[model samples]
Target: MESAQRHLRMALDAARMMIWDSELSNGKVIDSTVKWFAAGTSLLGLPPGDLSQPFSTFLQIVCPEDRDHLLDTMQEAVDKRTGYEVEYRVQWPDCSRHWLAAKAHVFCDEHGVPVGTLGIVWDITERKENEQATARERELAAVTLRSIGEGVITTNAAGVTDYLNHVAEQLTGWTLEQARGLHISTTLKLIDDTGAPIPEHAALQCLRLKQAIGASSHNQLVTRDGRHVAVEESAAPIWSDRGELLGAVVVFRDVSHERKLSKQLSWNASHDTLTGLINRREFEVQIADALHSAKQDNHVHALLYMDLDQFKIVNDTCGHSAGDLLLQLLAKMLQTQMRDSDILARLGGDELGVLLPHCPPDQALLIADQLRQSIKNFRFVWDDHTFELGVSIGLVEINHLSKSMTELLIAADQACYLAKERGRNRVHLYQDSDLRLARRQGEMLWVSRLNEAFEHQYFRLYAQPIVGLCGHGGGHDEVLIRIQPAKGELILPGAFIPAAERYDMMTAIDRWVIRAVCRHVQSVRDSLGPQQAYVAQRQPAPAQYSVNLSGSSLSDEGLRDYIIEQFVEHDVAPEQICFEITETAVIANLIKAQDFMAGLKALGCRFSLDDFGSGLSSFAYLKALPVDYLKIDGVFIRDIANNAINRAMVKAINEVGHVMGISTVAEYVEDEPTLAVVRELGLDYAQGYAVGTLRPLSVSD
Candidate 1:
């Protein structure tokens, strides 16, 4: 143990001496008096024997791969008398080889004869393996950097391009050699969405702050050919292992396709496919923005809700393909006439809305008039048949009085309704009372309630029998709608129907009544069959039960189809159904309504002109409507005995119906005298209290 300690101390002292001496040669220390390797002197795992033999045996213990080189290094050291260092593999006692570095210096006599050698052997196996592993990692890193799919670039602290991968070189049209060491701003240019240059120093600032920037920074890069390419890129500070900031690494991908797809999606979402106009949703957005701008700037904006008058006639007569073409042409015409700042949008169906920013009520009316004239002058050609078209416009202006976009639209819609009421193919401005009344009436709420009423079966049908006047027992019955008021007594059609028409709820109500009457006919088929058969010989087979249809419903493409489906489903003949459309509807959409009536008539269904003399009473429209009955207006009949004009009008209607082989029915014959007058006038039927009031005929009884 004492000897081992002494040897260990000697090894330590020798290592210290080698470390301190820079010029010591292999034999220089051998000739010195100080002992180098004593007999049986070994530190760590080295074997001790004859001192020189032990040292020589150490070199021979090197692995076969390194033995020759180690021997050559020893010979070189002895000949030159210089210090030597070499790393070689040595086999241990267990036959496992480990690497060692031997650094030695030789000490020599005056004639340069070798005396002794001093050396230190270090176990550098771990470090050597680590160096080989590091070399492998560097090679793998270079391959990965070049093989990356996305463009990659690295910059130094000065925002200069230090390295660029192959992809980066291809993206920028610059080779790695050309781009390296160039300022990043000069080699790789970035711009924003607007094609404005993005501050090149921004990335450097982020690196200096050791922060990360993601793709949202709008970094669009320009290629060498000046073609802009969309880029989604992220950058982060490149930091050393010890947390020292180096520069930045930016990785990016070309997003040109994605950008184009995004733009297409946006356009599709905001514009109508058929008309290439703004859609309802986009229209609302524009209106909201207009309202906001108006409020901020105290400017005026006009809203016009224009409905094509009798456009359904064109569609019904010419088919939807022609109708679509007409609409497209009308949109083009409107676009040609309107200012670029004004927005026109199809609000579905035959309705169109326009937003005119910075326009007042007077200017809005003028513009609306121009649109109306354009429509009136426009001739639509459907399969070589040319027809004139027109529009009824409702105009309203935004001011402090306007509350919301919806309210403004409603007001404009009411004004448009008034224009149609006054006679179509005209334009009217919204009155203050229109908005006030709409607000007070809560018309929209009523429309919603009407929908609920139909859903909940809250409506009832009341039949008024059109009794034969000349003691003839059989006559038809007209089904009238009776709406149950929310708070009070039941309301008749006269009281609520106008409101229904104003709000466009009449169409839905008309549908419900048609379905209801079909159901009723099915329910009472057995009881009413004989009576219907008796009346059929005198009138027409399949004795008609008149159900009034609104103008809106007549215009519905699905209406005729729906009614036909219901009739087929219920196994009811079409001849048993009589659709009563008012003279107003017939004249307003004469061509379309006539075609629709003709189509129904082709299916064996019958039609009647209800309230016959109420409208303009155009003989042309009456001749065109394909009607089987003419129900004289109640106003004329109520004053038939007192007013000569009313009597003459009723007589004229009766004469025309007779001449046309159409039955004439007089309505509102409240007294015996009025009924007697209607009978004397040769009217086919009379519907009033005096003409045998309605009775609830029960099937069981």
Candidate 2:
């Protein structure tokens, strides 16, 4: 007995190490190093009253779900000297859980007959965690590469392209299968404006320099089938852990639309419609620049603020159509009169401003006179009405003594008014003091900012927990979007989404959110549990996510396909994701929303009607739309504990939803009482401050 105790003591030297030894027939335990597996004490199987049956006590600690498998495996190897090994979870004496790997070998007598079995138990909780972590890291890395909007390509040291993503294939007009083993020079054919091939390869340059290189906007890709696409590309050398060069990874984005729209959208955002000229906002910007030049470089510039004479009379007598025609013709006429460097803008109404850089006061007046004469000579014949327009020009000379663009503009405007008062067709020079420019920013700036954000990957994703009321663990977290400005400030979607929706930028934002969420889910899936965990009977750990879509997203003809493609690329099961659409959004574009919902549902995704009761015809649309969840609006859930009407409304909604075979999620639950009420009302999930505040999901998560 003392010898058996010494063997157990030797095994006890290692933490969490345990041993089972049989010194006699029928395999009685000599000793146990772990108290949790103490002899004659039932930690899981037999009651404490039965102390003689140590094996029965051991059975109590093995997790019931894993016990049968462990026993079967051990019994199979009980006759062999090769022994047996199995990993299974166990419940400790204190009710804690742990994973243990047991390795056992059957003891043999001198006559080569089986006697008893000896086994060692090792705590392998860390190893299990490490395996899960490794799985998550691999999944995350894969999804991140696949979900990025840009195309990625990797090449060997010899500059041969070996990989291409879906976007790259579409952009370069070559499939990965066809492009494999092709040289970068052949795969990427860049042409300049003069129709000549670019001199050097970006990938080669990165390898040679051992750094990063970028492609210029002046370069255009001549596709395999001869389509010319403007692209922006960057390449960096891939390195091994030991500081050796592996190859190069080239990332490129199809900026053909961006290049075209940067010029077109920039112009339309800050220009006049009736005339091809800058608008009031743009004119103000030029004046500010002219003011700065005058103050710093001592350079002189001139501003001409002009108003069309008899424009109101033309509008009233000849109708506004004739007035618009006359304005367009006058704009063309003024364009011919200004120098190449001069700036012309239709400020507002019938007003125009011309900025002449490095021009003296005399030259400015002469130019203004020329514009007036040109306008007077031009005649517009719209239908049968022939009309002539004249200009009253106000001129102001900006020098080192000039104050602000605002003061200069006002002085020039006042001079133009004086010219209107004097005779109405001549140019007048103004002499006045200057002060700062009045600023009024509009929503167009947000569109430009969003575009820039997309270009630079400046958006962030956040998540809020949607706790499950039932115990089986079957709810998805709601993903939220946030913007990171260039200056490093975090801006919530509420501050910018309205502008995004107004400018038709929601489609792009939606794509970004979906991709980010896919990558996020892929990387975190292991720790959160397998996406199909709940489906497995023995291991039921549910993990899923929900993402919101904008109303404008329904208008995107390709959104459904894009989502399916993302799921495929990220290797995510559609059942793991639920898309949330607002009631107002669904009703706004009912047909499109229905089509989108049906298409995604066909792909195995679930849908939820968010803010479900906000619309007047919520239940009517609810019948039309097939949604898995009906999220009760905060108005009915926020104070349901105190407000009887809210409580009644919530109850009605929950009952109706259940009748329709849909679950109910109550939002804005802010206290224990409200949570209690929601649970009492049979709500499936509750989300808000009391449940849990939103937490930012890191790349690590």
TM-score (all chains, Cα) for each model: 0.46, 0.39
Residues 1-701, model 1: lDDT tens digits:
99997787677666432221212234432222322243223322456532333344454566788887876786677678777888788777667777777787876778777655566655677877677556544543554475489777777767898777777787887788888988877667788999887765445666767798766545678887787788777767765433446677777778888888998899989888889998888988888877777777888999889899868998889899988888899999889999989999998889999999899878888888888898899888777788887788988878755688887777888888888878889988888887666554666666676776667666877777877766654477888777665576776677567668788787778877777878777777645678785674476455558888888887888888888988986667888878888888777787789778988999998888889888845676566667888889999999888899999998988897888888888989899899889999889888889866654422221
Error of 1 at 292 (Å): 2.9
Predicted model with the maximum lDDT: 2
Q: Native-vs-model 1 lDDT?
A: 0.75
Q: Flag regions of model 2 displaced more than 4 Å.
A: 1-152, 165-170, 174-181, 190-219, 232-245, 251-255, 433-701
lDDT of 1 at 44: 24
User: Residue by residue across 556-580, what tens digits does model 2's lDDT show?
Assistant: 9999999988888877778778999
Q: What are the RMSD figures for all models against the true structure?
A: 25.6, 30.1
Q: Which ten residues in a row have the lowest lDDT in candidate 2?
A: 433-442
**What TM-score, to 2 decimals, does candidate 1 have?**
0.46
